[model samples]
Target: MKINPPRQAQEWSYSSHQESIGEALSSPGIRSNKKTHINCGSSARMAGNVCANVDQIRRQGRWNNTTINDAYLTNLPRELVRSMAGFPTYCRFFYLARAILNPPTSLCKKLFPAIGE
Candidate 1:
């Protein structure tokens, strides 16, 4: 004898406070990219505290007018990408081997132009 109950599909419901997935994953520091900030509690619940991308960091770096060359940061580790706005953790051998080999000399020039010359 079958003792299991039949499964039923439930209707999907959306709350007015719920935000889109893109909005949920977007970082607040990337405002210069023209993304609107969703001011609701659901975004955190939907995306948790760890959502970031390299392209987002590149845009933010350019927006902030940072001296670091974009080429060096393309393959940055996920953690570094997330903290590009703040202080980045320095683990060059493991995380930034490629960038280290090809350093951001432009950044050095911007910081110490006299030495660069």
Candidate 2:
């Protein structure tokens, strides 16, 4: 123990107001990329406690569930989703012939400078 010095104590933090998830979502600053602060009310709900904001450390809450698609997949094109109901037989054959004559592959590739490989 001689080699290791005693732990230095730091000042404690405390807060006394409560906040709701809706209130946080309503705040304009929060988007898919915005950082959020969540306070979990445990078995013992302490009074006057403050919600802490952890910047680098990751945390999630109710707002996470509100989105149908995961963040990574959200950026993908809408066409990636196939038609729920199949197209009419005649139309499908027509498109198939047209695709053979002029393939749509060229239309699918686009380069966005911001998102570089």
Candidate 3:
């Protein structure tokens, strides 16, 4: 549960300020209409996905464009979002469902270091 070490081990940054759960999840500088877009801040529990605009979709084709309506944005993959946010491999899966579903698919996709290695 402790992400940071004790003061004897390592000193915390004085400049670093704690953000609220909503602030931690918000996608700043993104201009979005609430009816059409859902930022990570929209739901406290669902930090796994964030609304991506149409321009973002075209720029990044990794997400499924067909699943969402044009009026609304698409959700990015949790793995990707977590990585971008500098989460470690262990910290990426925030909940049980994501922990259960993501690893197998991710492992299958890798070309080297076969399973159980």
Candidate 4:
């Protein structure tokens, strides 16, 4: 399917080099041992939801950090990843998503005062 171009075009920077997915992932600094830590704020933590201590959990290797090595994308489809990466890197789409999640009344209001208003 052909995607409609945005009214304002976005420019994407191209990296000089490209390599296989495996090579790209393991090419140093790309791999990570830290698992994803999503903080749902103090309210959620106090309500006994989500982990409060990411380090503690990771130390035990139970819910520890995850490494973003080549094998990390083993389950994810390559085509999907490529498709997402291929899309124009417009940042407006991201702002729309952020506004939906947190609304402008919070931090976004202050951070993006002119735009949020």
Candidate 5:
């Protein structure tokens, strides 16, 4: 089987919500509370929840705007593309190709590496 490489590296940035969560977590006096916040959900938590949705969408091929080709190959950064290309064909095809073709939202990318992979 022939394997094609991704054209570019997928780049994503942290949402404001995510930044807030990191700030909360990394704050000096904040206690480590494992419980999910009842009122204001943390950015990391929200991101994790959204990632689950993205994975479901990808596996089922249910994203409204996503095309088959989009799910197969992503436009990752040059460095990432090179790294992915070094992996086995099937891995590259499924991970890089599917990710690019599907192109997850920024939230999904931050929450789930698998979704962005």
Candidate 6:
């Protein structure tokens, strides 16, 4: 079935490049090492690159007290952290399920016709 034009437009608008970058930077789970910096080509690349650097630090047993965790996580809004955590591959399906099971009526009706079927 075809989606409404306005709703389709809204979805497209929400998933823009800027939004993705914002999501990555604002995520609470991302930990960065202050002493050793990874030079990502741009601000956009820094987020993923930081994670990779953390992995490298982990492999060499160099991740000292700089590891990211809930302590620093509290600096970000809880809701935003929750949203970021939901992006992991393992959590995506569960996130979608939760959204479907308890969505606002307007979104539920618009996204899932079966809800009104």
lDDT of candidate model 5 versus the reference:
0.42
Model 4: residue 45 alpha-carbon error in angstroms: 45
- For model 3, residues 54-97, the per-residue Cα lDDT tens digits are 44644443334453323233354545666666564454344544
Q: What TM-scores do the predictions have?
A: 0.15, 0.15, 0.19, 0.15, 0.18, 0.19
Candidate 3 residues lying further than 4 Å off, grouped into runs, are 1-69, 75-77, 88-117
Residue 27 local lDDT, model 5: 67
What's the lDDT for candidate 4?
0.36
lDDT score, residue 117, model 6?
Answer: 68
lDDT of 1 by residue, 1-117 (tens): 222323457433343213332344453433322223332223322222234343454454443324223222333355655467443543232353445475478887788889645
Regions more than 4 Å wrong, model 4: 1-78, 82-104
Clashing residue pairs in candidate 2 are 15-48, 15-49, 15-50, 16-48
Residue 2: error of model 4 in Å? Answer: 27
Our tally of clashes for model 2 stands at: 4
- Could you report the Cα RMSD, in angstroms, for every candidate shown? 17.3, 17.1, 17.1, 19.7, 22.1, 17.0
Residue-level lDDT of model 4, residues 3-115, one tens digit each, is 23334566322221222322444665465332122222223233222323444433333332353212221334434554476533432232333345655466766777787
What stretches of model 2 exceed 4 Å from their correct place? Answer: 1-64, 67-70, 75-95, 102-117
Q: How far off is residue 53 in model 2, in Å?
A: 33
Better of 1 and 5 by TM-score: 5
Q: Show pairs that collide, candidate 3.
A: none
Which candidate, 2 or 6, would have the higher lDDT against the true structure?
6
Cα error of candidate 2 at position 27, Å: 40
- Model 1's alpha-carbon lDDT is 0.39
